[model samples]
Target chain A: MSEFWSDYTVRVVVFGSALIGAVSGALGCYAYLRRQSLIGDVVAHSSLLGIVSAFWGAFLLTGSGNKSLWVIIPGAIVAGLAALLLTRAVTGLTRIKEDAGLGVMLAIFFGTGMMLLRWLQRAQPPIPGRSSLDGYLFGMSAAMTSQDLWMIGLIGAAAVITMLLFWSRLKILTFDPEYAAGLGLPVRRLELLLLCLMVIGIVVGLQIAGVVLMISLLVAPAAAARQWTHHLGKMVGLASTIGAICAAGGALLSAVFSHLPTGPVIVALVTLAFVASVLCSPSRGLLFRRRFVVD
Target chain B: MDIAIETQQLTVAYGAQPALWNVNVEIPSLGITGIIGPNGAGKSTLLKAILGNVPRLSGHVTLHRTDEAGSAAIGYVPQRSAVDWDFPTTVFDLVMMGTYGRLRWFQRPGKREREQTRQALQQVHMEEFADRQIGELSGGQQQRVFLARAFVQRASIYLMDEPFAGVDAKTENMLIEILHQLRDEGNTIVLVHHDLTTVKDYFDHVVLLNRKLVACGTTPQTFTAENIELAYGVAGKQLLSRIS
Candidate 1:
């Protein structure tokens, strides 16, 4: 057990997962409240394209496959933001609703990302970091370094600070956007910022839970937290804590076990938490709700 | 003869269809004005257009507020259906949103704001339900909570969309009494009102719409059966005849 503390990779992976989990879980409440939970999933899936693009861009720029955190983080952010922008533009300008638009964009971006990753794998010259590309799909927490931890910490801090600064306006905007506008608040800008924050949340955790399962870390904790609290502040706080615990617990389990995958482990723990919250919550739980129906 | 708000050649459309077409009217200062129209007659559209919630295809809504120097402080009570009632928030927190507009972009609601929110809840008789989650409230209580949200804001003009819909008689009377009190407190209140029988009792001025201005004047003078018929088509005759 002492060896677990000494292994640098394990420490990095566990801490990184906890940081990413807390940030995404906190920010995920906005998407959940706005009834746009799918957008977070879409943004996370769309980030795969950004991850591949960063590899390509880095390989072309320096004549070597620079699959570092610096190159990848910005690439993921741009792609996530692009996906959100395209969805917004399509929904705004055309008769296509947001659901249809997001689905189409998700397919296009994810398909392209999958193809690019294959191409990198089959490259004749053998891309230097091409072997590590698949780690982003299911998240290779074992491969995480102190540098990756630093990047996650920086982005997570940015997200938490921005959330604190715009807390009230965001609450109003999430609960009632029309009312926000009627009060002469800049509704469009605040909404755009909210989506941008979602992108930040997704981007920070892209490598920890990977593109495919990272969304669960955002969603499950929030859904669980909602069943337990009626206040927005408490919900967000509880969600963040739940996310951190699930992720850290998953990291510990994967570390102790020989063959377990980190991302799916974290996601599974969060899902279990969600189910427990649904069944056992004191006030809004399924069990409690049925009992109070006669009154 | 003071006009608090005036719309000139206002036109709005959703997709190919026009919701409001070439609407022109003046809302008088410091009185309760009822914007009366049949279902889909653009009554709600007019308020949204005036508040700039939706895009105006073309036209101008000019606000004439002598009290405030900058943009007029406008409080809005959108239809109950406008917001998600099951949202995770308490009555107090929702009402606290009303004071958010008065602060700077990044400023949080302080102690004074909380005091004002409590007062607003007290005024609406929702002070006791401050901690209750919004979804737990009845329809009438929800309406009252919405009213409290709007009332927390100190604005010169209040635009309410169907504050009387789906509410019981006791709640309706309380809302009317509150509206009259707000008008008496020197604020211009405009409502997109239904219920033809109560038009005379509730509103002092009336603006009837049928995708265009049918007639707008004093309730006693212009809220006649003919104007009601002009906007509501054949259904007006049966409804108004019963009331008269």
Candidate 2:
């Protein structure tokens, strides 16, 4: 226990995980508001293809796999946006519903990622010292360094700023898109901007929450927070706090154990919070409903 | 004396079916213009077409000056069922959203915006329910909250669709009073209305539509039994006679 406090790597892991959780929480509120909560999973899963493509592309072009974070981040964001546009186009052009569009996008993207993974395995190995991309597939909290912590913190701040800057427009657009447009709001522009931000957050979160469970961090905290409040600002704040606790607790537990996967543990903690919130929240919660007058 | 909305051979359709065709009409400012017709008579379609919510197949809609000063500001209050009411938002927050058009990016709502929201809530007699969740309110209260949101837009021209539909008697009366107030303040208010019983008593200007303009003028002039017959078919005459 004493050595755990002294270990610099443990500190970085804990801090990075917590910051990533907070960012996901903030972005999740908008996702839930848009009623596309599960789309976060779609965005996260689609990034795996981005990762492998960037790795292989960098190796083929420059004979290196240890590509800069800048290269990988932009590649992931472009792929994510392409997937979003493709899903939307399919839904609008066809009779398929939004949920079905999301499902198709998720499956097709994940399958493509698997194909890319197999191709990466077959290809000749590039320059050494570049780690396998598994850290993003399933987060490696123990391997987090000071640099990763700083990066996560910067991304978290940007996410928070995005939420605050467009809070009013987002609220109007989500609640009533037609009326918002009637009032001269650039509804389409605002919606596109928000979707862009969502992609950025999902791509960055891959480092700490991993591709598979990153979306759980985005949705579970916001869904849990929804059980407690109807006010948007309060819901966003509550979600961020809940997510931070889950991430921190998961990181601490993983620090104690030698080989436990931090991603699943963090997701499990978030799921537990959601269950508790569902049972204890004021209006919709099972227990609290007994106190309110039934209409 | 001033025209607020004018259409030139306006045609609207949804997929293969036509909702409104060659509907030419001129709406006056500074009064409540009631648009009443039978089901599928393109009442709501007319409103949507004018606001550009629905795509127009042909013709043009020219929106003139809202008031004597000629400001082009417009406001809209859609039907309650058009949106997901369970959205995570409070009455105050939703009303404050009306100020988003005026504020610059990255700036939060200041004290003036909050005060305007409060005043709008008071206008609709919803000040007491400002902090409540929108979903927790009754049907009438929810309508009033939406009205409050529209009021906060503070535009000189307002377009509303079925604001009194499914509301209680008190809510209906309250809406009439607010519309009259807005009209007296020199704002043009157009409503997609039903219930012919109160048309003459509540509204001054009227537009009788049946996929085409049947009549347009004061309620006594355009809402006659013949125009009602033309717009609503023979069965509508009996329905209007009972109420009239």
Scored by TM-score, the top model is 1
Reference-based TM-score of each model: 0.97, 0.90
lDDT by residue (tens digit), candidate 2, B148-236: 88888788878899999889999999988998888898888999998888888888899999998899998878988888889888897
- What digit string (tens of lDDT, one per residue) describes model 1 on residues B35-103? 998889899999998888878889999989733536565788989898887788998999999988888
- Candidate 2, A1-295: lDDT as tens digits: 8887788888777887788778888788878778776777888888777877887788778776754455566667777777778998997777788889988888888779868877666656534434556767776677666765666677668867877878778778878888887777777898887887677667766766788888888889999999988878889899988888898788878878867788888989999999999998877998777643412
| Cα lDDT, all candidates | 0.88, 0.81
Candidate 2 residues lying further than 4 Å off, grouped into runs, are: A125-131, A291-295, B9-22, B66-71, B210-215, B233-238
Candidate 1: give the clashing pairs: none
DockQ-based class of model 2:
medium
Error of 2 at B208 (Å): 3.4
Candidate 1 Cα outliers beyond 4 Å, as residue runs:
A291-295, B66-69
Q: Score the docking of each candidate (DockQ).
A: 0.63, 0.58
- Each candidate: RMSD to true structure? 1.7, 2.9
Q: Total clashing residue pairs per candidate? A: 0, 0
DockQ of 1: 0.63
